[model samples]
Target: MKDRFDYGQNPEKTKGGELIAAYLCDPETADAEFLLSKAKYKAITGREQKKNADILCYQIRQSFLPGEITPEDANRIGYEMGMRWTKGKYAFFVATHIDRHHIHNHIYYNSTALDCTRKFRDFIGSARAVRHLSDRICLENGLSYIAHPKLHSKGKFKHYGEWQDDNRPPTFQERLKAQIDSCLAEKPQSMAAFLQAMVSAGYEVKHGRGGVISFRAEGQKRFTRLRSSTLGKGYGQEDIQAVVEGRAASSEGRGAPPRKVNLIIDIQSRMKAGKGPAYERWAKIFNLKQMAATLQYLQESGLLEYEQLEKRATGAADRFHVLSGQIKSIEGAMSVNAELKAAIMDYAKTRPAFKGYEAAKYSKKYLAEHEAEIALYRAAQATFRHVLSGAKLPKMDALKAEYQKLAAEKRAAYRDYRAVRKDMQEVVTAKANIDHLFGLTDTQKNKEQER
Candidate 1:
């Protein structure tokens, strides 16, 4: 799960930035987790899913509360998070959130520490690497992970890594409202009590106008106006009806749970064996989400056909795959010389490992100097046998020659381009010099001479 949490100051209590910072960053704090963005938050996801979100902050908090602090207490929280994660060493980068709904903590940390240093280490320049770490942290901490390509608002739905902001997940309040409303009826007695009841009943409550409480339950809305008339008048028609209707209106619990969403990666993990509710929740994390749909809607702006989404996704995948394959090939090529050198060194270090039994004391380090060509020779012999036995394909000397020829041609082409560029510069200089001289000479009748 990937998540960003806003640890607030109990609203009625003192708001201290230092305490939150100290708690979150204090290398020794426990029960803490971090999130990279609010993209998949109930605040974000619930809106599109159920029509609204229920988040309160988007920035890091600094107090005794958890998950909302930073550098001010690094070592303490580092050790704390590390111990809970059961990994030695940890590192998390703090971020500032400008969104006011939630004063959240964005955590980017590692699960394991360096074996050599025992201190958490990270590749500071890699966002992808950080995402992996962020995903791991979310799962371990029961947070949600967001996949990239955030969905857009007014477009046909896009898939993973394709959605823009318009199709993003529901906002926090929406989700909160839904969870609160699940199999729940709004209690008009008091807003706070109504919210508390909803929460206890596994619903996330949202306050509406006229003291009305609105929430979503099983994909539908359940709203009721709050009033003191019922209590003061010893229950009116609506109240009498509510008591009679609330029971009749009470819905059967789905008996399942919410799904786990990976907004950043557009992935949903399976529920653990014992976590029934979670399994139900994660089961819903599918290929298509409103965020993606929203993006698709925005992109196409008309009734969508299945083929278009598939086509775009397939093309994008194929292109990325090609790039991935090329990268792998380049990496292999870069390692060739190193591998050849290492093989030669290995042959020298342990000559007996091969057919050659050179019996002389030698330094282990000698392997670094000579094993490559030796391996090549051995390979050639194997190839010769393979050809003789007719059990394997014959070696391609033509291919080798062609490859070397291409390499040489490439080098030559580069040299030629450089030479041509230099010559062009010389020509330009000569022309400039001629112009300077002619200007001093003052040939005023050049127009007629040209004709």
Candidate 2:
């Protein structure tokens, strides 16, 4: 079992509703968002009517041993755990999500108490307390709990889905680590040789006053100390020195042995077109290797039949289309919001100038001097007034703040959109490659038609 907390809500952020939607998305599950409300305002609308936006909600998650508990049981356990932990002080909602590899619980609680007077005390070490409370709950429910000693200190905290879907570029350190491992595999004769090899690999090497070496990988802004703890023990100065002296061979002792990947390319078969006798033999070998790789991929994925491959590929494509549509929708909304905010700001800024222009009775000299400003004011005034539509316009600062909030939401939405986009691209690429291997591409169809 594991627990994580998203502590202390930011005033600008509005993730409460999104969190609710995410955890309650599984249609098959009952009692999703099982609210344990203590406040007089039970419904979300009533809760929002309080008008206290700061610290809208507190979100936390508890993940269980996969395949151990059913969704129904998990929901009950999560509800019980949430209520007990909150001590009936804060109104909370428990949502058990069974859509991924792990059955997890998402708990969101109103920061304000039932009386709507006092707020939840979010002090230092509150996260640990929540985990401890969860462990007790798990143990009481006959579920295994992760003990303190078994927990990892420095580790990824993302849920399985989030981690699998993350598609950000590799960090500089990751690239550098791969380079170092590859260089070490070649068995460099000395530290100097290693440094030279690093430079050749497109990294800038700098020696400090105390014999410490730092490396700056290509496109990296800062030099990283080669002895930093983030690189682990074996990649440090002492470890490299040991390797240079032939005391250590590779990074294998520091971690698991590297797994080799076999490539799939059929160069030898192509060479067998009889262009040249000697080259044909080599080409045959290359073609055999490529076919071997493709076959291996199919075997691993259990894609034994053409129909299976086709279905998988088309499914991936369909998902890509859906995700593309979602991205476009979000982008469109963001653009409209931005344009509206800009128009409002422009109208407000040019109000005084417009008044002066009106008082001057649309003088040609004044119009020429501030044509753009006057036109913007005239164009936006009606739109802005129409937006207000019989209601008094809010303060300029308030409008700007609302725009900022919308902008933040758009940014968060884009982050998710980008992750989905990356996933779509990967699946689409895999599908195309599979189709090509099977001679199912449009080009192949054209060739068959020609034949």
Candidate 3:
């Protein structure tokens, strides 16, 4: 950024190529013109070709060293990258050894196409691929490469308000859950102990409409947990006691039931893989041990009532495991096909024979045959990719529209199940609270035993 300079929208140094070649030798006029024409400048910058040409000249020296490279070494590296990356159907420019700060090259390749089509437009993820290419080039030469800024920020996920880059306020549920979690985390225990801990943490609890509960800290309503929704995972003593007993308790007593427990874990495995980029959305969704634990928790707590009644929901979850395997296979095949296509197309681009059958390179027929193979391979690869993408799923035009429909139905089912469990737990928490905290009378005990 610091080194790059502008020469307006057009270049005044018409012999910019000669300037580049000057590092190796005093380039002849004919050779300079040939270099400029080879740059394919018009194809790359489109209407702004000359502007790009000037910038390339300005930046080329920073890319490599002029005094260090031998003439043959410069030619070889230039020829090699040209062969390795060029798309056979695109116009590309290449120049080297300019007597500037360094003996580097500039390539003004037609970012659009040589197939005389805009097929590359909106094509895959190639738009931001230059960073990968630049790093790869430095790596190939055993040189240090600069890291892209966005790539470094990719994994910084946090739930804190100050952590958010966007200024939007957190959803009420999110704020409430954070507060509840903070209070309960003072100490960890079964449902009763957690409620007792919340009380000790100086939270004043009160009931809200629709069976919800609010906890205020320092006279400020900082948290609220819903009683019956499959929302945040906090529960009040009443909410916990009501679950195991199969009904909300008439009064706090000593007839509480046992608490339900669940486990969560993240697991990973490795595979022998090749050089292509693999798509793995399914991998995050499918972990056998975690899924098994979740399933057992749901069953022991009676969370999936409809699935338990018909025995279909657990089976559907099992099918997701199978789907994960299929996705892995699809990604592997796509990787192989795409990599092969790039390698072959690049070879043809710099091979001279494909450039209208120059004798120094392969024959035009040879390049034609490779293109035919790429077409066939691309077709087959796409079919497999579509199949593994779960063809049975309905197409989603809007992210929220799809999430809303899926999450709503799933949450409704989960809510019914969690509510039943919560009712039972509330009975346990209430009974425990009375007996332990307030102490029970003989008559109250007799009544609890009578039930």
| Cand. 3 TM to true fold | 0.28
> lDDT value for candidate 3?
0.41
Give one digit per residue, the lDDT tens place, for model 2 in 1-451: 0122222121122133222322222312211222223232343214342444345457778889988887677767777776877788666666566667887777776665653434575874577778888889888888987763233233336554444331223467866776787788788888889898999988999999899899997557999888849687677888888887889766754655422222223345545654566445434444444454455556776878778766765675576577667656765655555556767777877788888899999899998766656776876777666565667656667766766776776677667666765544443444455555666669674453222
Candidate 3 residue-wise lDDT at 127 = 31
TM-score of 2: 0.34
TM-score of each: 0.22, 0.34, 0.28
Score each candidate by Cα lDDT: 0.37, 0.62, 0.41
TM-score (C-alpha, index-matched) for candidate 1? 0.22
Q: Model 1: which ten-residue window has the lowest total lDDT?
A: 112-121
| Residue 1 local lDDT, model 3 | 16
Tens-place lDDT per residue, model 1, 208-267, is 665454444444455332333422231222432344344323221323232222222212
**Candidate 2 lDDT (Cα, 0 to 1):** 0.62
Q: Give the CA lDDT, 0 to 100, for residue 228 in model 1.
A: 36
